[model samples]
Target chain A: MATVRIVITLKPGVLDAQGQAVHQGLRALGYETVSGVRVGKCIEITVPDQTARDDIDAMCERFLANPLIEEWRIERDQDRDGTGRSRVPVLPRSQGS
Target chain B: MMRFGIVIFPASNCDRDCVHVLRTVLGHDVEEVWHEAGSLDGVDAVVLPGGFAYGDYLRAGAVAARAPVMTAVRAFARAGGPVLGVCNGFQILLEAGLLPGAMLRNDVLRFRCTTVHVRVESTQTPFTRSLRDGQVLRMPIAHGEGNYFAPGAMLAAIEEAGQVVFRYCDAQGRVLPDANPNGSIRNVAGVCNPAGNVVGLMPHPERASEELLGSDDGRLLFESAVMWLETRKRSLVTPLRGSR
Candidate 1:
């Protein structure tokens, strides 16, 4: 089985109200280094065998994220060892990569 | 007679509200179209009602925008048919590319449900034909993601083209930051396509169409659409000069 990971974030110039609130909260808690913040979502899915990158891209475009305000990037977890090592992110679609 | 079609997607809680407004209050024929259906039948106007379509899962209106019924809705809009998208419907229209710009989370970061004052920015569109410029109306808005955003160039173009239909304003029709319920750029509450056939707004006009419910200003929008359709039909039947 292979694991698929997707990250979704709002496009630039779009307001991130929740992120701003979190940043304010962090600042209120005396985290002086917190300059700015933008909130995003990470989704993970498990699929059998090597799934086509185009299929995942279509899923993201059609259902996973809204292209008008949000953009999504997909990555596969190729190094899922028993030790729970860090997984490297790969670009499923070369969008300005 | 005007026939209105209210699209019903999974988890669309506001479909019946629109149906009631169109059928019971307005005395027009209304149809409840399922999201999976591919045809709109013979409805004169299509309305994308409010509520969390497809449970608003991945993104608000993202899943529902790709439903089979939307294809037909797009086709209808392309042919200059009138389409009104309210609240979640507006977000769906934005995602579907039928309208420009996108809706973002409210700057206050909360689900705001209250009666707001909006001024008629343009009176030429089918949705606002009955209204006059600067006319203040009380309408109800209920949504979490109602902040309208567009790129600078596109925003300027929309303003220049008179596509802005309604703008959040004070009771005296003054545009101010505090009057804006959401953080929409330029306080835009509703906008129409360049051709003025498709309109998308974050307010629940259907919910405000009756006097007993508080305000009936929303009825003017429906009346405007009906008037435009009737005028269009008349013009089609009798073309002015030379053509015949």
Candidate 2:
């Protein structure tokens, strides 16, 4: 099995009540048009190389993403060559590390 | 004047309580310093009281970190004044860069409150002078964000330097993981800056100062600061001109 790394994060510098905040002006205006406004989060994951993207998606929906509070995206990197042995994925597919 | 100032932002409900303990029990003159005002000119000590500052609107202390008063608080820390940030105040201190790392949500995802055990890990600073190394004290705590986290090396450095002032403990003061209230790393409940002049704790010591209210262990923290000040005051000032 091959190995890869996955990092899930709110979009860059997103207003993460957990990370950043809305520009003060955006909130004071009460743009009721804004409906519900909230920040997001960052989650990092590692997995086996051949693990289908669908399986990863399921993991996120079932556990990582709390539908009521957040939105997220995933990033990936392959263990290509050197030191790949040290970057094994806990998911069993990327076990070299 | 034996003046102490508390940094107050929008939702700091505990500022007055910290002051009450400071004024009534600790017997020191205290004031509520608004974060919008941003100055610690005459305060001998600075306290960051607990409560949901900025409604805990942004990551516990994140929003409050940018408040005007924090600027003064930061300067006060740089000048070596004794600073104590309790509960959310601790979170603010970290967010202001006076301390290290950030606080995260409870691992269990629930608001926790009640009496918890804490062990005095050090007595070197003004706050802990009343405590003995390894002594145990139970203090009441109420908060949603009490987990303390820091990088591995930073944690080790604080320990090696004797800056880790308080640790979560068992009833008898024995520190154990089971006593860890928020699933924090190493059961750490409090710590100080490298200079030892700044201390931050998650427990509400102010709540425990009166025997009628609960335990009296909280009084020591305030008393220790007074003792530290009395001893150091002579060194910092010369005899008054009229006294002679």
* Lowest-sum lDDT 10-residue window in model 2 chain A: A12-21
DockQ of 1: 0.52
In TM-score terms, candidate 1 sits at: 0.87
Q: Residues A1-97, candidate 1: write the lDDT tens digits.
A: 8878888998886889989989999999999898989999988888876789988888787777777678887767755446444455555676694
> Please, what are the lDDT tens digits per residue for candidate 2 over residues B1-244?
3788877889898888888998987778998888888578888888899999888763677778778777888888787778999999998887777876557566555578889979998787678876788888778988877877766777788787777889998888777878888867688899888777789999998898899977988888888887777767878632211221
**Distance from true position, residue B131, model 1, in Å?**
1.5
Off by over 4 Å in 2: A1-39, A42-97, B236-244
Q: Candidate 2 chain B — worst ten consecutive residues by lDDT sum?
A: B235-244
Where model 1 places Cα greater than 4 Å from the true spot, the runs are A24-35, A45-63, A79-85, A88-97, B236-244
Highest TM-score, which number? 1
Error of 1 at A86 (Å): 3.9
For candidate 2, lDDT tens digit of each residue in A2-90? 44444444343222333313533465767545544444554556566677888877866544543222345555554433644434454
